[model samples]
Target: MLSTSMTSAVIPIRTVYGEASTGTSSQPMNGTVVHEQQVRTARSYQAALSDWKRWAADHAYALHTIQPEAWSSNGGSIAHDKFSDLDMLIPLLADKRIVYLGENSHGVAEFNLVKTRLIQYMHQTLGFNIVAFESGLGDAALAQGQIKMTATQETMMRSIFGVWWTKETKPLFEYMKETHKSESPLRLTGFDIQVQSPLFQNANWIPSNGLKDRALQAEQEVHKWRMSKDLSGFRKAKRELIKVYEELLQVVTKNENALKMDYPDEPHIVKLMKRALEDRIRVIQEFNELCIQSNILTEQEDYSASQSMMEWRDRAMASNLAWLATEIYPEENIIVWGHNGHISKAQSLISTMPKSMGELMSKELQQESYVMGLFMGEGQAAENTREPVQLDPIIPGSMEDILSAAGQPYTFMDLRYRENERGNSWIFERMIASYQVMMPMSLELRRHFDGVLLIKQVKMPTYLPHKVTKQIG
Candidate 1:
């Protein structure tokens, strides 16, 4: 269980523009003090805005405006003209083997559509064949198999996508199905951690009676130990569960011949069983590690532990992506989709954090990886409470502010060679602002991404499917 108490000393308050108070001082005459205080506050606001405006004007050349019609036909299927804005980005995409499309959140419909169109363009023109998402690796693999087997789109959406199940994402799933008809079909993969879901237990590969019962029993035992406040006992039970899963994996692998003989009519059952067992083993291993961290770390160290877990998850994603690129599709280009934070190439806000997936892959792949960060200047953003809130205007001295000042409805700026060629300055190093999980965060732009895609306005994703609601319930 997590702590519910607030640990920080500071109180959070909203800042209202032009609401600064003039200070009252007893040392001086009241009229003089009030006049001087008001002058100081007014000067401060004006100076900050002026400084930001100067920076924006100086760096305006670094940005390239992107028209909405460049990527989408609005509703048509015709090819984009050579003069379209995507023409400016085609060379950039062509130079990289992997492209990371980072979103601010999972609920922005316009951003999702932009990504979908990009994926379609890459698939149709550039021949990028694999699309990897930040979802559970095991669950996505299972869902892909189901999709290939003609499963309902609703089932695939519910089983694999989690919060990314809005109607804006429907085209992605439809594309995957349509691509399956080609000689060289497109692939969808998940590269996140093994988040254990109930869907995995009913994957048609696990035996309905005995094996499923044993697996559930092991999980229950671990949960029982966890809730009892017996850390050592929990660790012990978790390790035992790990062994059970490992043994089950070995059994499935070693007896493939005999298993095939027993289930003669369903030869693919053995492979599915192997996948299921492997997924179980990975989940148990992750669970045990979490238990160990919980036992060793104190309550104050909870945040540190969380950062460690986040790094661990990103490393796992990078490793899985490497596996897919090398072992699964050696000749194919890969595209990754996820939030800006996880896909950033720069260090996160936490100082001790390790490289994110994008950073790690960029280092390994060098020029083969390209990362793009997306931003919205103002719009409605979805929250976890199933409500949408209006986004406050971009903050002064932030990247979004600079972009908004450019007066472009959409823009794409290449950051890879800007600092080296255009001279390193404060504008190149300023932190970019974004909202994550409904909270605002600022990150360095040039260090984290190679390019940015900015949309002047956005709207909440309203086309969430019934399956998503049902699954959440």
Candidate 2:
């Protein structure tokens, strides 16, 4: 018989959430500090089920995935097939106003498996709707707006189109187009940029009209920078050049009045001007340093750099949020797919504003709809071989290690490393390069959503030792 003390031993449910604050009690792992919300005791996995049920009911959402924290090489036997992917969450999410799909980490094949499954669910089960990516922001803007692409924007779009239309990303668009035509007619949005040739060509030449000679001279200074025989260095030069041109153009573009400008503003304007000038000088000095980081840049002088991509990401997020504010319906089901970084709470666009244009429009249009983020698991064993963690702090051992330590029984899965040179080459080095692109999208999830469901997995090896530590004196 179990003793009363043994039965009553408390197991604290420790939760680390993004919203927790730092510099306070019970600091959250993600830099936020939060007090322990509650304490509970459970005798078995079955008892813990009640806690999850209660959590789901209170939050109006269901989280379906085995926690890595639950896996212990010493604690018990773990099975390879123990975890559930998005397919398990689909039915639960059927009634949701919005479903956020965050990809697994870079170089993790399991994420692609999850993504494929989600796409299938969206097609066969959910039907068509808007499909957002971590990439494709510029093209999305062009598709939505009636205004002709500015020379700069057009170049940016073409560059992006060239990069993403390749083998790796082509299927995502094909899937979107096919599904859109059949079901809901999807819209595309992204927060990525193209950083290569043809698109970055000197297409935006200032007209040699009398007042713009300085602009032409600046462009020439940037062009001569190409002789360094390094594409990455030249990209820095181009970004600097573009910044200078934009500042110079701003002066010519906007007519100023003295009254609206504070006399103190003159000093501010001077500072701004000096900053722009100095930026170009800094770019020249840092050109050599930039070249060393160029392995990610294409061998061909064809691709663009992260600066333009980051700029485009901001514009895309702004535009998409604006569109959502108007067109999205309250209580209607919506699903958004993007990279892990883009949907995180800290940098996401949605979290930054309480009432975005999309939120306002959503309120006026949809009623009381909600948004949420799906934080995908990355850098864990089940995700990426390129990056791996030996232990989980909360659990204190590997999936195998924990089971061994605890003298528990478990099964393990066979995880194989598969690499597609054509398919995955660009994902880390080039694709999803800008953290700015990922941040805002994730923020919106944390801010606008009623609750979040994080998706992660653990891959257990097939072999395990019968004993972890033999106490041989």
Supply candidate 2's per-residue lDDT for 418: 18
Per-residue C-alpha lDDT of model 1 across residues 1-473, encoded as one tens digit per residue: 10113211111222213336666554556545433344233334344445555655555433233222232323223264533446556777887788889887666777777787777777766778788887766556556655656544653563455556666776677766666666545567676655434433543344445765676677555444433445556656667677766766766676667655543323244654465456556645664455446546645565565566567667767777776677666678988888887788775643566567776663567468888888887788675344687777655445666566666676666777564322223335445356353344445567778888777788887555443221110
- Clash count, candidate 1: 0
> For this target, which candidate reaches the highest TM-score against the unseen true structure?
1
Each model's lDDT comes to 0.60, 0.34
Give lDDT for model 2: 0.34
Residue 156 miss distance in model 2 (angstroms):
16
Per-residue lDDT of candidate 2, residues 187-245 (tens digit): 45433322112111222222334335555566456435533455565666566566655
Q: Model 2, residue 399: displacement in angstroms?
A: 15
